[model samples]
Target: MTEIRHYKIGEDRFKISEDEVARRELKVTKVADDVIQIQEEIHGIIALVGATSTVNIKKDELKELIKIVREEFGWTDIC
Candidate 1:
């Protein structure tokens, strides 16, 4: 059986899944001043594809990102 879950740690959010074919993960973290980091990865026969991006964002940009993530993940609150 495959299982998928979403959770949060500190100022970060995560979604992880493990199944027969692959393991997939996504994470968002607020790092330092005006910076946020986003990462995604998939582990499988194709040699794990891991990618990461960092954005130096203003308060409004951060708020927009948070709102989008919260809506996508069905969360009422996030840090």
Candidate 2:
């Protein structure tokens, strides 16, 4: 069995798991355009097409994003 830990970056941008990092399954980085890129890897080596969105989100936008991610990905309750 593999032990997994969690890592968080930025103030409110990400919540990553140790398994994800060790396997390179996820990546989130802030680009110079004030946007964040969210990536996921599949099948051990295949890289899925990722999404990039503005990171300069206000309170309302943050709430919306949290809601969407929660509904789609089952993220932890942020509200």
Candidate 3:
């Protein structure tokens, strides 16, 4: 089994695991600013695929997903 951890960057929080950290071709370093940087491998692949097949999720939807994950893990707000 793999263990995942969630951390709040400023006010928002997200779940990420050790495996994900290692495998992520794109990094969401500063979520608050919505600034994401993709690695060369990911960039090359994305360039070929293009950004046409994308789903735009609302902020509320993302918040709900985060809430569900947090609740499932019995996480508490320490901050």
Candidate 4:
């Protein structure tokens, strides 16, 4: 198994490196009326295909998601 290391960059962001020069961007799209798909791409190359979930994101679930983003980005609250 490969051991992944985490580095804390300046204030609110970090970089994940794998000894490769790649600029990855996450793409989230509504593949179907109710199905959502996510993917990771680097220079137009699809690196990973993310999970597909229902578009019906509940209130509680959304709150938890918001909390996760806020904590990770060092955002205590949104203005």
Candidate 5:
């Protein structure tokens, strides 16, 4: 079974998972914008890891990998 996780970005809350479920609705706030920035930072870290690795992964794959890592590390409150 695929696990589902929800996140709130700038006025744009969404859920991600290995499954194909639609995201839940969320409210937008200044904090949400900040969350988006942190998410970008997470993506940056993933990009860096990809750059340093021998594997030639695409940006989308890197993003998915990052999400998995974050979930494993219990980094739900990254921002």
Candidate 6:
């Protein structure tokens, strides 16, 4: 599978995603699940779109998903 890459240019950040899903909601929402919704703003209609607001995941599955998200966006627990 192809992976998206993140980079820094001066004070700016950027991402190049070959994966279609990565470009849709994932960039704005991600695992934080904290994207503010403006009144009347419509959600994107894309692949993997779901009607439910939440999903039940196994502990191990969540852990692994988090690790991937962190690494994908160059996030770390340390400053």
Model 5 per-residue lDDT at 29: 20
User: What would the TM-scores of all predictions be?
Assistant: 0.35, 0.29, 0.25, 0.30, 0.26, 0.31
Best candidate (score: lDDT): 1
Tens digit of per-residue lDDT, candidate 2, span 28-70: 4333233445444333333445586333434654565555455
Candidate 1 vs 6: which has more TM-score: 1
Question: Where does candidate 5 have its weakest 10-residue lDDT segment?
Answer: 37-46
Identify the runs in model 6 with alpha carbons over 4 angstroms from their true place: 1-52
- Model 5: lDDT equals 0.36
Sorted by lDDT (best first), the order is: 1, 2, 4, 5, 6, 3
- Whose lDDT is higher: candidate 1's or candidate 2's? 1
Native-to-model Cα distance after best TM-score fit, residue 49 in candidate 2, in Å:
24
Q: Who wins the TM-score comparison? A: 1
Candidate 3: tens digits of C-alpha lDDT, residues 1-79: 4444333312222335443322112211222222222222222122255555443345654564456434544435512
lDDT, model 5, position 77:
59
**Candidate 4: stretches off by over 4 Å:** 1-20, 44-79
TM-score for candidate 2, residues paired by index:
0.29
lDDT of 5 by residue, 7-49 (tens): 4332222334454333222211223322322232122112243
Off by over 4 Å in 1: 1-20, 48-79
- In the range 1-79, model 6's lDDT, one tens digit per residue, is 4343422111212243453222211211233333212111123324455675643344554464456445654456522
Error of 6 at 24 (Å): 20
Model 5 / residue 47 / CA error / Å:
28
Please estimate how well model 4 matches the true structure, expressed as its whole-model Cα lDDT: 0.41
Give the alpha-carbon lDDT of every model: 0.48, 0.41, 0.34, 0.41, 0.36, 0.35
Better of 3 and 5 by TM-score: 5
